[model samples]
Target: MKGPLFYAKILLFGEYGIIKDSKGLAIPYNTYQGALKKSKNLSEVSKKSNENLKKYFDYLVGLETTLVTFRLVEFKKDIEEGMYFDSSIPQGYGVGSSGALVASIYDKYADDKITVLENLTRDKLLKLKQIFSKMESFFHGKSSGLDPLNSYLSLPILINSKDNLEATGIPSQKEGKGAVFLLDSEIIGETEPMVTIFMNKMKNEGFRKMIDEDFAKYTDACIDDFLHGNMKSLFGNVKHLSKVVLDNFKPMIPTAFHKVWQKGIDSNDYYLKLCGSGGGGYILGFTENFEKTKKILKDYKLELVYRF
Candidate 1:
Protein backbone atom coordinates (compact mmCIF):
# COMPACT_ATOMS: atom_id res chain seq x y z
CA MET A 1 0.00 0.00 0.00
CA LYS A 2 1.34 3.45 -0.90
CA GLY A 3 1.10 6.03 1.82
CA PRO A 4 1.67 9.81 1.75
CA LEU A 5 4.75 11.49 0.31
CA PHE A 6 7.58 13.08 2.30
CA TYR A 7 9.88 15.29 0.29
CA ALA A 8 13.50 16.08 1.11
CA LYS A 9 14.40 19.61 2.30
CA ILE A 10 17.27 22.01 1.95
CA LEU A 11 17.94 24.73 4.51
CA LEU A 12 19.16 27.38 2.11
CA PHE A 13 20.18 29.66 4.92
CA GLY A 14 19.82 30.41 8.64
CA GLU A 15 20.85 27.10 10.23
CA TYR A 16 21.73 28.08 13.79
CA GLY A 17 20.34 31.59 13.57
CA ILE A 18 16.82 30.29 13.12
CA ILE A 19 16.99 28.56 16.52
CA LYS A 20 17.56 31.96 18.12
CA ASP A 21 14.61 33.32 16.07
CA SER A 22 16.79 34.73 13.28
CA LYS A 23 15.31 34.80 9.79
CA GLY A 24 15.84 31.69 7.65
CA LEU A 25 14.49 29.84 4.59
CA ALA A 26 13.96 26.15 3.75
CA ILE A 27 12.89 24.83 0.38
CA PRO A 28 11.64 21.40 -0.54
CA TYR A 29 14.18 19.46 -2.63
CA ASN A 30 12.12 17.21 -4.83
CA THR A 31 15.11 15.34 -6.25
CA TYR A 32 15.05 13.07 -3.20
CA GLN A 33 11.79 11.94 -1.61
CA GLY A 34 10.32 9.09 0.44
CA ALA A 35 6.94 7.46 1.04
CA LEU A 36 5.60 4.63 3.15
CA LYS A 37 5.03 1.29 1.43
CA LYS A 38 4.10 -2.22 2.60
CA SER A 39 5.92 -5.35 1.43
CA LYS A 40 5.59 -9.03 2.32
CA ASN A 41 9.28 -9.46 1.58
CA LEU A 42 11.71 -7.27 3.55
CA SER A 43 15.37 -6.63 2.91
CA GLU A 44 17.81 -6.47 5.81
CA VAL A 45 17.63 -2.71 5.71
CA SER A 46 13.85 -2.82 5.68
CA LYS A 47 13.78 -5.24 8.57
CA LYS A 48 16.14 -3.03 10.57
CA SER A 49 14.12 0.07 9.70
CA ASN A 50 10.87 -1.57 10.75
CA GLU A 51 12.34 -2.80 14.00
CA ASN A 52 13.63 0.66 14.87
CA LEU A 53 10.32 2.24 13.94
CA LYS A 54 8.57 -0.17 16.28
CA LYS A 55 10.75 1.05 19.12
CA TYR A 56 10.01 4.65 18.16
CA PHE A 57 6.29 3.92 18.10
CA ASP A 58 6.49 2.30 21.51
CA TYR A 59 8.25 5.37 22.91
CA LEU A 60 5.60 7.68 21.45
CA VAL A 61 2.83 5.43 22.74
CA GLY A 62 4.35 5.43 26.19
CA LEU A 63 4.37 9.24 26.24
CA GLU A 64 0.59 9.25 25.78
CA THR A 65 -0.97 12.59 26.81
CA THR A 66 2.39 14.13 27.64
CA LEU A 67 3.41 14.01 24.01
CA VAL A 68 1.23 13.27 20.99
CA THR A 69 -1.83 11.08 20.96
CA PHE A 70 -1.79 8.26 18.42
CA ARG A 71 -3.74 5.10 17.59
CA LEU A 72 -1.26 2.95 19.47
CA VAL A 73 -3.15 -0.32 19.13
CA GLU A 74 -3.52 0.14 15.40
CA PHE A 75 0.11 1.22 15.08
CA LYS A 76 1.41 -1.73 17.08
CA LYS A 77 -0.59 -4.10 14.90
CA ASP A 78 0.89 -2.54 11.75
CA ILE A 79 4.40 -2.78 13.19
CA GLU A 80 3.82 -6.40 14.06
CA GLU A 81 2.69 -7.08 10.50
CA GLY A 82 5.97 -5.60 9.16
CA MET A 83 4.84 -2.18 7.90
CA TYR A 84 7.98 -0.34 6.70
CA PHE A 85 9.20 2.51 4.59
CA ASP A 86 10.32 1.44 1.13
CA SER A 87 12.41 4.45 0.09
CA SER A 88 15.39 5.49 -2.01
CA ILE A 89 16.40 8.38 0.22
CA PRO A 90 19.79 7.62 1.78
CA GLN A 91 19.99 7.30 5.55
CA GLY A 92 22.58 9.23 7.62
CA TYR A 93 22.99 11.57 4.67
CA GLY A 94 21.75 14.53 6.68
CA VAL A 95 18.81 14.73 4.29
CA GLY A 96 16.16 13.61 6.79
CA SER A 97 15.92 9.85 6.39
CA SER A 98 14.38 9.51 9.85
CA GLY A 99 12.26 12.58 9.28
CA ALA A 100 10.40 11.11 6.33
CA LEU A 101 9.50 8.06 8.40
CA VAL A 102 8.36 10.22 11.32
CA ALA A 103 6.22 12.36 9.07
CA SER A 104 4.69 9.34 7.38
CA ILE A 105 3.91 7.70 10.72
CA TYR A 106 2.18 10.83 11.95
CA ASP A 107 0.20 11.15 8.74
CA LYS A 108 -0.99 7.56 8.92
CA TYR A 109 -1.35 7.08 12.67
CA ALA A 110 -1.78 10.30 14.69
CA ASP A 111 -5.24 10.70 16.20
CA ASP A 112 -6.69 14.19 15.87
CA LYS A 113 -3.35 15.53 14.66
CA ILE A 114 -3.03 18.45 12.25
CA THR A 115 -4.01 17.57 8.72
CA VAL A 116 -1.88 18.65 5.78
CA LEU A 117 -5.05 18.80 3.67
CA GLU A 118 -6.60 21.54 5.80
CA ASN A 119 -5.57 25.15 5.41
CA LEU A 120 -2.62 25.02 7.77
CA THR A 121 -2.38 28.30 9.64
CA ARG A 122 0.60 29.50 11.63
CA ASP A 123 -0.96 28.15 14.84
CA LYS A 124 -1.45 24.71 13.34
CA LEU A 125 2.05 24.78 11.97
CA LEU A 126 3.44 25.46 15.46
CA LYS A 127 1.39 22.65 16.94
CA LEU A 128 2.57 20.24 14.26
CA LYS A 129 6.14 21.30 14.83
CA GLN A 130 5.74 20.64 18.54
CA ILE A 131 4.33 17.18 17.90
CA PHE A 132 6.96 16.27 15.31
CA SER A 133 9.67 17.50 17.64
CA LYS A 134 8.50 15.11 20.33
CA MET A 135 8.16 12.25 17.90
CA GLU A 136 11.53 12.85 16.24
CA SER A 137 13.26 13.17 19.60
CA PHE A 138 13.39 9.36 19.56
CA PHE A 139 16.07 9.62 16.86
CA HIS A 140 17.93 12.81 17.62
CA GLY A 141 18.11 13.68 21.31
CA LYS A 142 16.54 16.98 20.27
CA SER A 143 14.85 18.13 17.10
CA SER A 144 13.71 21.42 15.51
CA GLY A 145 10.99 19.42 13.70
CA LEU A 146 11.79 21.39 10.54
CA ASP A 147 12.71 18.23 8.62
CA PRO A 148 9.42 16.46 9.22
CA LEU A 149 7.51 19.73 8.92
CA ASN A 150 9.01 20.41 5.51
CA SER A 151 8.63 16.78 4.45
CA TYR A 152 5.02 16.77 5.56
CA LEU A 153 4.05 20.07 3.92
CA SER A 154 6.23 19.63 0.82
CA LEU A 155 6.39 23.46 0.57
CA PRO A 156 9.05 26.09 0.72
CA ILE A 157 9.15 27.15 4.38
CA LEU A 158 10.26 30.61 5.41
CA ILE A 159 11.45 31.41 8.92
CA ASN A 160 10.73 35.07 9.61
CA SER A 161 11.74 34.70 13.23
CA LYS A 162 11.99 31.89 15.82
CA ASP A 163 8.23 31.58 16.24
CA ASN A 164 7.02 32.86 12.87
CA LEU A 165 7.13 30.82 9.67
CA GLU A 166 5.01 30.05 6.62
CA ALA A 167 5.10 28.17 3.35
CA THR A 168 6.51 30.36 0.56
CA GLY A 169 7.24 30.24 -3.14
CA ILE A 170 10.77 30.71 -4.43
CA PRO A 171 12.08 31.55 -7.87
CA SER A 172 12.58 28.51 -10.03
CA GLN A 173 16.05 27.50 -11.12
CA LYS A 174 17.46 29.06 -14.29
CA GLU A 175 19.89 27.61 -16.83
CA GLY A 176 23.17 29.38 -16.17
CA LYS A 177 26.64 28.79 -14.73
CA GLY A 178 25.33 29.84 -11.34
CA ALA A 179 23.80 26.83 -9.58
CA VAL A 180 23.38 25.16 -6.20
CA PHE A 181 24.72 21.63 -5.97
CA LEU A 182 25.51 18.99 -3.35
CA LEU A 183 28.93 17.37 -2.77
CA ASP A 184 28.61 14.18 -0.74
CA SER A 185 30.82 13.84 2.33
CA GLU A 186 30.68 9.99 2.02
CA ILE A 187 30.06 9.76 5.79
CA ILE A 188 27.16 10.22 8.16
CA GLY A 189 27.03 13.13 10.60
CA GLU A 190 25.43 12.63 13.99
CA THR A 191 23.25 15.59 14.95
CA GLU A 192 23.73 15.59 18.73
CA PRO A 193 27.49 16.14 18.91
CA MET A 194 27.43 18.74 16.17
CA VAL A 195 24.63 20.59 18.00
CA THR A 196 26.63 20.36 21.21
CA ILE A 197 29.58 22.09 19.58
CA PHE A 198 27.30 24.86 18.40
CA MET A 199 25.80 25.32 21.87
CA ASN A 200 29.20 25.43 23.55
CA LYS A 201 30.33 28.04 21.06
CA MET A 202 27.22 30.07 21.79
CA LYS A 203 28.40 30.70 25.34
CA ASN A 204 30.85 33.29 24.06
CA GLU A 205 29.43 36.76 23.40
CA GLY A 206 31.84 37.20 20.49
CA PHE A 207 30.31 34.29 18.56
CA ARG A 208 26.80 35.59 19.23
CA LYS A 209 27.68 39.00 17.80
CA MET A 210 29.23 37.45 14.72
CA ILE A 211 26.17 35.30 14.08
CA ASP A 212 23.76 38.27 14.39
CA GLU A 213 25.93 40.82 12.60
CA ASP A 214 27.75 38.78 9.97
CA PHE A 215 26.17 35.39 9.38
CA ALA A 216 22.59 36.59 9.61
CA LYS A 217 23.24 39.56 7.33
CA TYR A 218 24.63 37.56 4.42
CA THR A 219 22.08 34.76 4.90
CA ASP A 220 19.16 37.17 4.75
CA ALA A 221 20.66 38.83 1.71
CA CYS A 222 21.13 35.51 -0.07
CA ILE A 223 17.52 34.48 0.55
CA ASP A 224 16.12 37.82 -0.55
CA ASP A 225 18.29 37.99 -3.64
CA PHE A 226 17.57 34.40 -4.71
CA LEU A 227 13.82 34.73 -4.26
CA HIS A 228 13.80 38.01 -6.18
CA GLY A 229 15.76 36.36 -9.04
CA ASN A 230 18.59 38.79 -8.46
CA MET A 231 21.55 36.67 -9.59
CA LYS A 232 24.20 39.37 -9.24
CA SER A 233 23.40 40.15 -5.60
CA LEU A 234 22.71 36.51 -4.73
CA PHE A 235 26.20 35.37 -5.69
CA GLY A 236 27.70 38.38 -3.94
CA ASN A 237 26.00 37.43 -0.70
CA VAL A 238 26.73 33.72 -1.25
CA LYS A 239 30.42 34.47 -1.33
CA HIS A 240 30.24 36.11 2.10
CA LEU A 241 28.04 33.32 3.43
CA SER A 242 30.53 30.72 2.19
CA LYS A 243 33.34 32.52 3.94
CA VAL A 244 31.35 32.77 7.14
CA VAL A 245 30.75 28.99 7.16
CA LEU A 246 34.42 28.37 6.55
CA ASP A 247 35.43 30.62 9.44
CA ASN A 248 32.87 29.79 12.10
CA PHE A 249 31.81 26.25 11.16
CA LYS A 250 35.29 24.82 10.87
CA PRO A 251 34.53 21.69 12.86
CA MET A 252 31.54 20.86 10.71
CA ILE A 253 33.58 20.91 7.50
CA PRO A 254 34.97 17.57 6.40
CA THR A 255 38.72 17.72 7.07
CA ALA A 256 39.60 16.43 3.62
CA PHE A 257 37.54 19.26 2.18
CA HIS A 258 39.38 22.09 3.95
CA LYS A 259 41.59 22.79 0.94
CA VAL A 260 38.73 22.70 -1.52
CA TRP A 261 36.73 25.01 0.71
CA GLN A 262 39.61 27.47 0.90
CA LYS A 263 40.31 27.06 -2.79
CA GLY A 264 36.81 28.20 -3.65
CA ILE A 265 37.03 31.20 -1.35
CA ASP A 266 40.48 32.30 -2.57
CA SER A 267 39.91 31.72 -6.27
CA ASN A 268 36.26 32.77 -6.40
CA ASP A 269 35.52 29.72 -8.51
CA TYR A 270 32.86 28.52 -6.07
CA TYR A 271 31.80 28.80 -2.44
CA LEU A 272 30.82 25.86 -0.23
CA LYS A 273 28.47 25.68 2.74
CA LEU A 274 27.07 22.94 4.95
CA CYS A 275 24.23 21.00 3.35
CA GLY A 276 22.65 19.79 6.60
CA SER A 277 24.51 19.60 9.94
CA GLY A 278 27.82 19.49 8.01
CA GLY A 279 30.13 16.95 9.75
CA GLY A 280 29.45 14.64 6.82
CA GLY A 281 26.91 14.07 4.04
CA TYR A 282 26.56 16.62 1.20
CA ILE A 283 28.19 20.02 1.23
CA LEU A 284 26.30 22.76 -0.66
CA GLY A 285 28.14 24.84 -3.26
CA PHE A 286 27.37 27.97 -5.24
CA THR A 287 29.18 29.22 -8.30
CA GLU A 288 28.54 32.06 -10.74
CA ASN A 289 29.93 30.02 -13.62
CA PHE A 290 29.48 26.25 -13.56
CA GLU A 291 31.81 25.49 -16.46
CA LYS A 292 34.63 27.47 -14.93
CA THR A 293 33.93 26.20 -11.43
CA LYS A 294 33.72 22.60 -12.64
CA LYS A 295 37.11 22.85 -14.36
CA ILE A 296 38.78 24.14 -11.20
CA LEU A 297 37.31 21.44 -8.95
CA LYS A 298 37.22 18.81 -11.69
CA ASP A 299 39.01 16.27 -9.54
CA TYR A 300 36.23 16.16 -6.97
CA LYS A 301 32.78 14.81 -7.91
CA LEU A 302 30.03 17.33 -8.68
CA GLU A 303 26.26 17.37 -8.97
CA LEU A 304 24.63 20.51 -10.40
CA VAL A 305 21.09 21.48 -9.36
CA TYR A 306 20.60 24.82 -11.12
CA ARG A 307 22.35 26.84 -13.79
CA PHE A 308 22.71 30.58 -14.54
Candidate 2:
Protein backbone atom coordinates (compact mmCIF):
# COMPACT_ATOMS: atom_id res chain seq x y z
CA MET A 1 0.00 0.00 0.00
CA LYS A 2 1.20 3.47 -0.82
CA GLY A 3 -0.18 6.88 0.09
CA PRO A 4 -0.07 10.19 -1.77
CA LEU A 5 3.00 12.37 -1.72
CA PHE A 6 3.53 15.19 0.79
CA TYR A 7 6.02 17.85 -0.23
CA ALA A 8 8.60 19.60 1.92
CA LYS A 9 8.11 23.26 2.86
CA ILE A 10 10.20 26.39 3.19
CA LEU A 11 9.30 29.08 5.71
CA LEU A 12 10.24 31.93 3.39
CA PHE A 13 9.88 34.53 6.10
CA GLY A 14 9.32 34.52 9.86
CA GLU A 15 11.60 31.79 11.05
CA TYR A 16 11.70 32.64 14.76
CA GLY A 17 9.51 35.69 14.41
CA ILE A 18 6.40 33.62 13.87
CA ILE A 19 6.85 32.18 17.36
CA LYS A 20 6.31 35.70 18.64
CA ASP A 21 3.14 36.10 16.55
CA SER A 22 4.88 37.92 13.72
CA LYS A 23 3.93 37.47 10.09
CA GLY A 24 5.26 34.42 8.23
CA LEU A 25 5.12 32.97 4.72
CA ALA A 26 5.62 29.32 3.88
CA ILE A 27 5.71 27.79 0.40
CA PRO A 28 5.76 24.19 -0.70
CA TYR A 29 9.13 22.98 -2.01
CA ASN A 30 8.43 20.20 -4.49
CA THR A 31 12.09 19.42 -4.95
CA TYR A 32 11.85 16.95 -2.07
CA GLN A 33 8.88 14.94 -0.76
CA GLY A 34 7.71 11.85 1.08
CA ALA A 35 4.90 9.28 1.26
CA LEU A 36 3.78 6.18 3.12
CA LYS A 37 4.43 2.71 1.72
CA LYS A 38 4.26 -0.92 2.75
CA SER A 39 6.60 -3.69 1.66
CA LYS A 40 7.33 -7.29 2.62
CA ASN A 41 11.06 -6.85 2.38
CA LEU A 42 12.18 -3.63 4.02
CA SER A 43 15.50 -1.94 3.50
CA GLU A 44 17.47 -0.60 6.46
CA VAL A 45 16.19 2.91 5.88
CA SER A 46 12.55 1.85 5.75
CA LYS A 47 13.05 -0.40 8.74
CA LYS A 48 14.32 2.52 10.77
CA SER A 49 11.44 4.67 9.62
CA ASN A 50 9.00 1.99 10.62
CA GLU A 51 10.51 1.81 14.08
CA ASN A 52 10.32 5.58 14.47
CA LEU A 53 6.69 5.54 13.39
CA LYS A 54 5.91 2.95 16.04
CA LYS A 55 7.22 5.24 18.74
CA TYR A 56 5.34 8.19 17.30
CA PHE A 57 2.15 6.17 17.09
CA ASP A 58 2.53 5.19 20.72
CA TYR A 59 3.00 8.80 21.65
CA LEU A 60 -0.13 9.80 19.81
CA VAL A 61 -2.14 7.16 21.59
CA GLY A 62 -1.25 8.61 24.95
CA LEU A 63 -1.52 12.23 23.89
CA GLU A 64 -4.67 13.90 25.18
CA THR A 65 -5.69 16.73 22.91
CA THR A 66 -8.98 18.14 21.66
CA LEU A 67 -7.54 19.34 18.38
CA VAL A 68 -7.60 15.95 16.62
CA THR A 69 -7.39 12.24 17.29
CA PHE A 70 -5.67 9.51 15.31
CA ARG A 71 -7.10 6.13 14.42
CA LEU A 72 -4.39 4.45 16.35
CA VAL A 73 -5.64 0.89 15.84
CA GLU A 74 -5.45 1.09 12.06
CA PHE A 75 -2.23 3.04 12.21
CA LYS A 76 -0.69 0.37 14.40
CA LYS A 77 -1.92 -2.37 12.09
CA ASP A 78 -0.17 -0.72 9.18
CA ILE A 79 3.05 -0.43 11.13
CA GLU A 80 2.84 -4.09 11.98
CA GLU A 81 2.47 -4.79 8.27
CA GLY A 82 5.88 -3.27 7.53
CA MET A 83 4.63 0.22 6.76
CA TYR A 84 7.36 2.87 6.48
CA PHE A 85 7.81 6.33 5.19
CA ASP A 86 9.71 6.34 1.91
CA SER A 87 11.09 9.82 1.66
CA SER A 88 13.65 11.90 -0.18
CA ILE A 89 13.37 14.88 2.16
CA PRO A 90 16.51 15.23 4.24
CA GLN A 91 15.97 15.00 8.01
CA GLY A 92 17.42 17.63 10.35
CA TYR A 93 17.81 19.93 7.34
CA GLY A 94 14.94 22.18 8.40
CA VAL A 95 13.08 21.33 5.20
CA GLY A 96 10.04 19.64 6.80
CA SER A 97 11.07 15.98 6.87
CA SER A 98 9.05 15.12 9.97
CA GLY A 99 6.37 17.57 8.92
CA ALA A 100 5.79 15.54 5.77
CA LEU A 101 5.54 12.40 7.83
CA VAL A 102 3.05 13.96 10.20
CA ALA A 103 0.97 15.18 7.29
CA SER A 104 0.94 11.78 5.63
CA ILE A 105 -0.16 10.04 8.80
CA TYR A 106 -2.92 12.55 9.40
CA ASP A 107 -3.99 12.28 5.80
CA LYS A 108 -4.24 8.51 6.02
CA TYR A 109 -5.45 7.71 9.53
CA ALA A 110 -6.80 10.68 11.44
CA ASP A 111 -10.41 10.21 12.50
CA ASP A 112 -12.73 12.83 11.07
CA LYS A 113 -9.73 14.46 9.46
CA ILE A 114 -10.25 17.77 7.76
CA THR A 115 -10.13 17.14 4.05
CA VAL A 116 -7.96 19.38 1.95
CA LEU A 117 -10.95 19.91 -0.35
CA GLU A 118 -12.88 21.79 2.30
CA ASN A 119 -13.49 25.52 2.09
CA LEU A 120 -10.61 26.03 4.58
CA THR A 121 -12.06 29.04 6.31
CA ARG A 122 -9.88 30.99 8.73
CA ASP A 123 -11.29 29.05 11.70
CA LYS A 124 -10.65 25.79 9.86
CA LEU A 125 -7.07 26.78 9.12
CA LEU A 126 -6.45 27.60 12.74
CA LYS A 127 -7.93 24.29 13.81
CA LEU A 128 -5.72 22.47 11.34
CA LYS A 129 -2.73 24.34 12.67
CA GLN A 130 -3.65 23.36 16.18
CA ILE A 131 -4.14 19.73 15.20
CA PHE A 132 -0.89 19.58 13.29
CA SER A 133 0.91 21.30 16.12
CA LYS A 134 -0.16 18.59 18.51
CA MET A 135 0.62 15.79 16.04
CA GLU A 136 4.01 17.17 15.02
CA SER A 137 5.07 17.80 18.60
CA PHE A 138 6.17 14.15 18.68
CA PHE A 139 9.04 15.25 16.44
CA HIS A 140 9.87 18.79 17.48
CA GLY A 141 9.67 19.39 21.22
CA LYS A 142 7.61 22.45 20.33
CA SER A 143 5.96 23.11 16.99
CA SER A 144 3.87 25.83 15.36
CA GLY A 145 2.54 23.15 13.00
CA LEU A 146 3.07 25.41 9.99
CA ASP A 147 5.29 22.90 8.17
CA PRO A 148 2.77 20.06 8.10
CA LEU A 149 -0.01 22.58 7.53
CA ASN A 150 1.78 23.82 4.41
CA SER A 151 2.46 20.28 3.18
CA TYR A 152 -1.08 19.12 3.88
CA LEU A 153 -2.67 22.02 2.03
CA SER A 154 0.00 22.05 -0.67
CA LEU A 155 -0.50 25.81 -0.91
CA PRO A 156 1.32 29.00 -0.09
CA ILE A 157 0.20 30.04 3.42
CA LEU A 158 0.31 33.69 4.35
CA ILE A 159 0.59 33.99 8.13
CA ASN A 160 -0.60 37.42 9.24
CA SER A 161 0.18 36.34 12.78
CA LYS A 162 0.00 33.16 14.92
CA ASP A 163 -3.79 32.82 14.89
CA ASN A 164 -4.32 34.44 11.51
CA LEU A 165 -3.18 32.62 8.37
CA GLU A 166 -4.68 31.64 5.06
CA ALA A 167 -3.77 30.16 1.74
CA THR A 168 -2.42 33.01 -0.38
CA GLY A 169 -0.77 33.45 -3.76
CA ILE A 170 2.74 34.54 -4.46
CA PRO A 171 3.97 36.47 -7.47
CA SER A 172 4.50 34.27 -10.47
CA GLN A 173 8.00 32.95 -10.89
CA LYS A 174 9.77 34.77 -13.69
CA GLU A 175 13.00 34.13 -15.52
CA GLY A 176 15.12 37.10 -14.61
CA LYS A 177 18.38 38.18 -12.98
CA GLY A 178 17.07 38.19 -9.40
CA ALA A 179 16.13 34.93 -7.72
CA VAL A 180 15.55 33.03 -4.48
CA PHE A 181 17.59 29.89 -3.86
CA LEU A 182 18.77 27.43 -1.24
CA LEU A 183 22.38 27.01 -0.19
CA ASP A 184 23.28 23.65 1.38
CA SER A 185 25.45 24.19 4.41
CA GLU A 186 26.48 20.50 4.06
CA ILE A 187 25.82 20.03 7.78
CA ILE A 188 22.69 18.82 9.51
CA GLY A 189 20.97 21.17 12.01
CA GLU A 190 19.39 19.98 15.23
CA THR A 191 16.25 22.00 15.87
CA GLU A 192 16.08 21.59 19.65
CA PRO A 193 19.49 23.07 20.41
CA MET A 194 19.00 25.94 18.01
CA VAL A 195 15.60 26.68 19.54
CA THR A 196 17.08 26.51 23.00
CA ILE A 197 19.66 29.09 21.99
CA PHE A 198 16.93 31.39 20.78
CA MET A 199 15.02 30.94 24.05
CA ASN A 200 18.14 31.80 26.04
CA LYS A 201 18.72 34.86 23.88
CA MET A 202 15.16 35.92 24.58
CA LYS A 203 16.14 36.48 28.20
CA ASN A 204 18.31 39.40 27.19
CA GLU A 205 16.38 42.68 27.07
CA GLY A 206 18.59 43.83 24.20
CA PHE A 207 17.79 40.73 22.17
CA ARG A 208 14.08 41.01 22.82
CA LYS A 209 14.15 44.67 21.83
CA MET A 210 15.97 43.92 18.61
CA ILE A 211 13.49 41.20 17.69
CA ASP A 212 10.52 43.51 18.28
CA GLU A 213 12.01 46.55 16.57
CA ASP A 214 14.41 45.27 13.92
CA PHE A 215 13.79 41.59 13.21
CA ALA A 216 10.00 41.65 13.16
CA LYS A 217 9.85 44.90 11.20
CA TYR A 218 12.13 43.76 8.39
CA THR A 219 10.54 40.30 8.23
CA ASP A 220 7.08 41.81 7.93
CA ALA A 221 8.32 44.11 5.16
CA CYS A 222 9.97 41.25 3.27
CA ILE A 223 6.76 39.21 3.34
CA ASP A 224 4.69 42.16 2.13
CA ASP A 225 7.18 43.05 -0.62
CA PHE A 226 7.48 39.48 -1.86
CA LEU A 227 3.74 38.91 -1.97
CA HIS A 228 3.10 42.12 -3.92
CA GLY A 229 5.90 41.30 -6.41
CA ASN A 230 7.78 44.35 -5.34
CA MET A 231 11.20 42.93 -6.19
CA LYS A 232 13.17 46.15 -5.68
CA SER A 233 11.69 46.75 -2.27
CA LEU A 234 11.91 43.09 -1.39
CA PHE A 235 15.63 43.05 -2.09
CA GLY A 236 16.20 46.19 -0.03
CA ASN A 237 14.28 44.78 2.93
CA VAL A 238 15.91 41.36 2.61
CA LYS A 239 19.32 42.99 2.87
CA HIS A 240 18.40 44.59 6.17
CA LEU A 241 16.70 41.42 7.42
CA SER A 242 19.80 39.40 6.53
CA LYS A 243 22.02 41.82 8.43
CA VAL A 244 19.77 41.73 11.49
CA VAL A 245 19.93 37.95 11.46
CA LEU A 246 23.71 38.02 11.18
CA ASP A 247 24.11 40.42 14.05
CA ASN A 248 21.43 39.13 16.41
CA PHE A 249 20.97 35.48 15.42
CA LYS A 250 24.66 34.74 14.99
CA PRO A 251 24.67 31.56 17.04
CA MET A 252 21.87 30.11 14.94
CA ILE A 253 24.12 30.30 11.86
CA PRO A 254 26.88 27.79 11.36
CA THR A 255 30.26 29.17 12.33
CA ALA A 256 32.07 28.32 9.09
CA PHE A 257 29.63 30.28 6.90
CA HIS A 258 29.95 33.57 8.82
CA LYS A 259 32.37 35.11 6.34
CA VAL A 260 30.32 34.01 3.33
CA TRP A 261 27.16 35.41 4.95
CA GLN A 262 28.92 38.72 5.50
CA LYS A 263 30.44 38.75 2.02
CA GLY A 264 27.00 38.54 0.43
CA ILE A 265 25.81 41.66 2.29
CA ASP A 266 29.15 43.44 1.88
CA SER A 267 29.17 42.95 -1.89
CA ASN A 268 25.36 43.23 -2.49
CA ASP A 269 25.44 40.18 -4.73
CA TYR A 270 23.15 38.15 -2.47
CA TYR A 271 21.67 37.96 1.02
CA LEU A 272 21.39 34.77 3.07
CA LYS A 273 18.86 34.03 5.80
CA LEU A 274 17.87 31.07 7.94
CA CYS A 275 15.87 28.49 6.06
CA GLY A 276 14.58 26.91 9.28
CA SER A 277 16.34 26.97 12.65
CA GLY A 278 19.67 27.68 10.84
CA GLY A 279 22.29 25.99 13.01
CA GLY A 280 23.34 24.48 9.65
CA GLY A 281 20.86 23.18 7.17
CA TYR A 282 20.11 24.84 3.87
CA ILE A 283 20.62 28.60 4.18
CA LEU A 284 18.07 30.55 2.15
CA GLY A 285 19.52 33.11 -0.31
CA PHE A 286 18.14 35.96 -2.36
CA THR A 287 20.23 37.30 -5.20
CA GLU A 288 19.59 40.27 -7.44
CA ASN A 289 21.72 38.55 -10.09
CA PHE A 290 21.47 34.78 -10.05
CA GLU A 291 24.29 34.23 -12.49
CA LYS A 292 26.60 36.57 -10.63
CA THR A 293 25.72 35.13 -7.21
CA LYS A 294 26.19 31.59 -8.50
CA LYS A 295 29.57 32.55 -9.89
CA ILE A 296 30.63 34.05 -6.58
CA LEU A 297 29.44 31.10 -4.51
CA LYS A 298 30.59 28.51 -7.03
CA ASP A 299 32.22 26.44 -4.34
CA TYR A 300 28.83 25.77 -2.73
CA LYS A 301 25.80 23.78 -3.83
CA LEU A 302 22.98 26.16 -4.78
CA GLU A 303 19.44 25.25 -5.79
CA LEU A 304 17.11 27.77 -7.39
CA VAL A 305 13.70 28.29 -5.77
CA TYR A 306 12.08 31.25 -7.50
CA ARG A 307 13.12 33.79 -10.12
CA PHE A 308 12.27 37.47 -10.41
> Cα RMSDs of all predictions?
1.6, 0.7
TM-score of 2: 0.99
lDDT, candidate 1, 1-308, per-residue tens:
78877877778787777776788788777777877766778889889878887888779867645546788888888877777887767776677777888889898988787776899899888888888888888888988888898888888888888577788888876665678877777888877888889989989999988998999899899889887889888878988988988899999888999989998888888889887777888788888888887788777777766666
- Give the Å error, residue 225, model 1: 1.2
Cα lDDT for residue 21, model 2? 88
Residue pairs with backbone overlap in model 1: 21-162, 176-307, 176-308, 177-308
- Measured by TM-score, the strongest candidate is 2
Q: Rate the local accuracy (lDDT) of all candidates.
A: 0.82, 0.94
Which is the leading candidate under lDDT? 2
lDDT of 2 at 34: 99
Residue 129 C-alpha lDDT in model 2: 94
lDDT, candidate 2, equals 0.94
TM-score of each: 0.95, 0.99
